[model samples]
Target: METRQCGPIGRPRGFDADEALERALLVFWEHGYEGASLSSLTTAMGISTTSMYAAFGNKEQLFRKALERYTEGPGAHLAEALREPTALAVATAILTGTVRSTTRPAHPHGCMGVQGALVASDSGREVRDLLVAWRDNSYSCVHERFRRAVDDGDLPQEADPGLLARYVTTLAFGIAVQAASGVGRDELQEMADAALRNWPLT
Candidate 1:
């Protein structure tokens, strides 16, 4: 049996390697790395084992590619939410959006990265590191927004940007977990709103 090759990260030449990666990503996202068996991946990817190995290198590499794809997809939106004019506004939007997005009827599996980390034993060091990096990056993005808000006078200069950023991310993470655990939209929105109202005003 011939192995199928995964195409380039963005654009492939002849075959839709990128598309295959996306399919594989969805399977992993819904099932988690451990739950997504090699057979399942091949079936989902529509490629044989040889091709899967040739294109993705290994299960680990495919998982990494899926993470990359997620960053390019969902992470882009999250980053955009951090750009709101007011820090509090941006924070609220992000928090609410996260809960809404996670709890949407179509996406019931929660965050792929968060699931990967919480399950723990299934992923390797690299996968864990990638999740950590994403979390750290998210906090930094929020922190930068807070710093900008302070400069723009929306927030007080005395507010600790780092702590504020961490808080925003922490709230977002809590929402993700809650959404995963079947939290309702109305209730989640209330929690998100209260969190925004508590933002340091000084």
Candidate 2:
């Protein structure tokens, strides 16, 4: 007897894994993990149960991968904005950009992560923890940037970067909620601009 190669050949699924993950992510983003049933994932991912299990493990594991992709893909821009030269610009970009993205025609319902968290229950500990951690880390990153701005004399010496960072993060999340609640883009932009202007920069 001779050992034989298993499954389809020819570059080993050049279009399968990536497409499946993308589809699964879209489903999870659209509907929270609990809400996105197996049938939904399989239908959206275009993969059978066996294939999904073999490629992405169990449901929880697959959900984690989807969340990771979200953070690394669609959500990456917000992290990038934290690297702006000044705290004011970073805050402005984070808040205003978020408002624009959330209220855009393509994503008018608001942020996937924020919406998912709101629908989660106590049993959804992993998902809740992931969202909280992501938000906390965002604050930390922005706080460090604010600290750099203070050190560079861009912001007032007496300004507390830590508090400012938390405030900015809060404002961003609040704007996300407002967008979800039917607040228009102009109002959110004005709010963000006024918030940025109020930052102490003596």
Candidate 3:
């Protein structure tokens, strides 16, 4: 009698995929796309070269998966920020979350989405483009939320949701850059507080 298996039978992965990808995420977050070598990623992820490729396809694909993990896990506050009750609350959530995430000691300082591929090489244009698209989509989501706020009378009807969205996004990106440059969390939070204090309101 012959026994059969459901999936392709290969050597069982010696690493926990979620944990390895999280390690890879941190490596990419710290080093950026062009800067992170396969050696560095695989070493940090505790996987061999062949295993890394077999598990995640290639470096680019691995980066993409790690990035997805980042936004879904450590970076999930971005999506949650838009769920605040009022426009001011939403802005506050975003700004506050940005400072916290960017300046936290556990993860690398700054945003993986914003700084991950800021200066990629030509060969890394695809990776950079992916990051850019993710950021742009996030901005669009914020803008739509702000637009709904206006319709719901949370923000003034005359408020330009697009401009407002740009303002908040710009502030978050700047905070990320500063945090990456060793700025303290308190300083960035002060900035966020000040920005919300002067918010355009009804």
What is each predicted model's overall lDDT from 0 to 1?
Answer: 0.78, 0.79, 0.90
For residues 97-190, write the lDDT of model 3, one tens digit per residue: 9999999887799999988998677999999999999899889999999999989998888999999999999999999999999999999999
Which residue pairs overlap in candidate 3's backbone?
Answer: none
**What lDDT would candidate 1 get against the real structure?**
0.78
Give the winner by lDDT: 3
Prediction 3 global C-alpha lDDT = 0.90
TM-score of each: 0.84, 0.83, 0.94
The count of residue-pair clashes in candidate 2 stands at 0
Candidate 1: tens digits of C-alpha lDDT, residues 79-176:
77877778877887888778776677865446776765554564466677778887888888888888888888888878888888888888888887
Task: Identify the superior model by lDDT, candidate 2 or candidate 3.
Answer: 3
User: Higher-lDDT candidate among 1 and 2?
Assistant: 2
Candidates in order: C-alpha RMSD to true structure:
5.9, 3.9, 2.2
Error of 3 at 30 (Å): 0.5
Candidate 2 weakest lDDT stretch, 10 residues: 7-16
Better of 1 and 3 by TM-score: 3
